[model samples]
Target: MNSLLIALVRALRSHCWLRLLGCAFILSSLGNGLTQVMVFGQLLRWNASPGTLTFAYMLATLPGFIGSVWGERLCRKMSPLRILILTEVFGMVALVFPLYGLLSHHIPALLVIQSAEALFSGMSYPALTLLFKRGLSAEELPAATAMETLIFSAQVLLGTGAGVLLFNVVSPLCILLLDALSFAASAILLLTTRKKFRVRDAQTMAADFPAHLPLHWKHYSPLQKRSILLLPALAAVGSPAMALLPALVQQIRPEETTGLALPLLFARSLGQLFGPLLLSADKLRQFSTSNRRILLCLVLFLGGYFLLSPLSAWPAVSLALIFSAHLASNVVFALGTFGVLQNFTSRQVATASALAWRGQVMVAGLATGAAGLLAESIGATGALYSISLASLTGVVILLWRYRT
Candidate 1:
């Protein structure tokens, strides 16, 4: 942990742009965490069915397909900084719908908020990723990513816990308002940083403002293509957990459905917080070269979910499983995302990032939609088990096919 902190401090101190973007990312992630809890918590309060909860998640993410295409065009024509600022601002405005939804107890308002936020998020992802690729050195990238995950998880931990506490004490409208404020805060920070970034690299900015044309898919090596798919595949498999959580809670702890949502999220975030820290240590570098280690973590990641279906009936045991599952997942996520980003060249990064994100959101959206339907038909536990088993089989085939 000390080493990780020192590394983060070093990275932030050395890079003015990173410092600004890091802060902005933190605020955005916090808002996301809080939003998850608040949205689901209110839905549970209304005695929403599993299908409804999962459908909400599906609507929130599926629009990213369009947004990614839109963002790609924007990145080709506009500055990344401008793209980010606009997306954040629009995202902030979109939250008002959710706030009204909470106030009026209207489901469509919530649905609108989900679709709008997802679109803006899709638009922002490429810009955010391109900036990181352009600004940081190769040596700095992994550390920065680790630090990013750590900060994201930590803030999410805080936000989820706070959401639970705030849910009881404050009105839902107030929670949504705070989330809007976070978006505003993040946008303002990005706006200020835009000037700093320009001053530091005016020439580079002018030369690279509108990125060059993307390389054709045929241009990428087989390994590079596989690397791009890995994260999205993992995400598709794991994405059902959040959408299914409300139902799982209501299933196992029917009397305490509202009470358990945040705790599960908190546990997952806590594991995510530690995963990067643990992996960042020097001792872990040996395993970094071994495909066997990747497979091992995959087992933990998928196996945790497989077990979660049956064990979710026990609250304490379920929390522990959630922690372990996400811990393994964080390792896979970091490795997989970095692998995709690193495979592309500077000119290709924007397109690659956009495509990668598009794949993730699209797959995850579909997976969540499937979970909703399955849950509606067979119940949440059956849905969970079915998804987990299918995911486990799919992953095995993927790894085997791609094995060197």
Candidate 2:
């Protein structure tokens, strides 16, 4: 018992700061999620008009579009830690930037605020990715991913609970204030880590920046180039699900929208947990290599979607099935994502991650925006079915080319 306790203590102390920042990053991210849900879910309360909420959501996505173009420049010169601290500080500013809308009743100001938040978030993901790479080894990446999913799981669980509890208890600005404080805490932690690492690099802003006259697209190997090209497509699929799901639920059962939709959200997180465990338990690899496992996971995931769509009456059951399928899709998606990512990059992880995230955000923003609008018109469930079917079909096409 004493030995077991000591071992547990040792494990807990393993790479303390990296783990800490990773955890804090999630907490702040959760706060962001809370703010977004509270605001978007109750858009009518914010003195909003029809389709304005949807527009706001899209505005929040614009940063990624711009982020991909410039993110790599910053990552190349700055430590991931520094990049995180800077982007998040800016993110806090972004979160608060919209208060003027409520204060003066200016719609355009609020739109700008949402855009800033998305922009800062776009800048932060690459830094986070770099930290994840630095924080874990090849063997530990799966566990690192588990921890990540767990943090996101808590975001949904905790943030939703808080958003609900505070709906009448506090103002949205109050929630935003708390997000700011979390950012401050995260920045402090990052500063401490920076001092500890004392990483001194010569990379300068000007050197890494896209040149004024012309941008130099770095030469990439065939596989690497293919991976970069594929990034936008893969991200497009992953980005749209959350924004669209609730709208879909509303279409089916407006009365039970939150209850039906939130649980489905939980199910995706739950599925993510289960999907990773399957890999952690060695089940995913029971078939073959990482590549093989990824393909199998995708194939099964698509099948899960087929099973999901046909269940007409049991919306609850259907939600669970569909989310679970998505969960498998996410796992393989992450596996394929990171597996390809780690292998694909010739540059430092930070720069590569920045480029990749930029691609993701660019594609994800468009996909999510489109999905949200489509959900309002087509019935959320049907839209999901079409997306699932179409996405799977596209994958089959890509895989055929992959074989050749």
Candidate 3:
């Protein structure tokens, strides 16, 4: 742990630009965390049925799919720093609609605003990945990614807790305002740090001339293709379980749903924050390949889901299971997937990251929609049991195919 901490400090101290970018990311995460709690709580307050809320969430991802389709071309045309700054500017503007909706007490307006936010937010991801690929050395990439993930987890943890407390005491509108200000602050940080970013390699810049979006399946090995395709399915596995959280909370403690939900979220985020630290430990890394690590995480996720399905009557136990599943799955799934992605050339990174993210969003949307319907038909526990079974099946298939 000390060695890992030392390496992280060295990386940050050596890379001034990384420090600036990390600060921006921290601010952005704070905004996102605040908005997430506010939006979901508002949806419940507006009496959006579970099915309706899930469907709205599904619809919100549609624009993200569209954004990913064009993200590659956008990255090809603009410097990543420029793209980053521009997206932040657009996101702040997009937040205005939701703020207006909150003021007017209009549900439809809020939904529309949420969808717009998803679109612009989705567009920024590829640009951010490209920046990391361009700016960091190979040795620095893993630690940098780990650091970013850690920061995000911390922000989510702190922000969710704070958002909930503030919302309870103040108003959701205040939370929304804070979110917008955070975005503005992040943009200002980015603009101020622009000069520190490395120049794009001239040769790589020249290669961007191909007008079409640049996915060439022929270039990837079969294993790589399988990994990419399965990533979305892996992501979809947890959607049902997560989608049922509000309903589950209501069942456990009807009046305290809002009060309890954020803490549960904080638990999961806390797990995610610590999960990557395990990766940095030489003892763990030396014992397993990335694929093996991912498989183990999947098993843990499946176990958690199955356990939670039957233990819904026990909120404390269910929360513990949720935290464990979240911790393991995030490290194995998200970070492990990115580890594979790093193997690709800079030219392919944007396309691969965008496509992979789009696939996850699309599948997660479908899963959430289906989960909502299932919850309506069966109880939330039954829906969760079904999701766990499906996930177990996926894990079995993955294991057989990889045979690692």
Best by lDDT: 1
lDDT for each residue of candidate 1 in 241-281, tens digit (9 for 90 to 100): 76787787787678887777678878888888777666653
lDDT of 2 at 378: 74
Ranking by lDDT: 1, 3, 2
Candidate 1 local distance difference test against the native? 0.74
Each model's C-alpha lDDT?
0.74, 0.57, 0.68
Candidate with the greatest TM-score versus the true structure: 1
Worst 10 residues of 2 by lDDT: 281-290
For residues 184-297, what per-residue lDDT tens digits would candidate 2 score against the true structure? 787787778667544322233333334443322365454443444345545555445445555545555556655565556556555654554344422322221334455566
lDDT of 3 by residue, 361-386 (tens): 78777777777788778866677678
Q: After superposition, how far is residue 287 of candidate 3 from its true place, in Å?
A: 8.3
Q: In model 2, which residue pairs have backbone atoms overlapping below 3 Å?
A: 248-380
Q: For model 3, name the residue pairs that clash.
A: none
| TM-score of each predicted structure versus truth | 0.91, 0.76, 0.88
Give per-model CA RMSD. Answer: 2.6, 5.5, 3.0
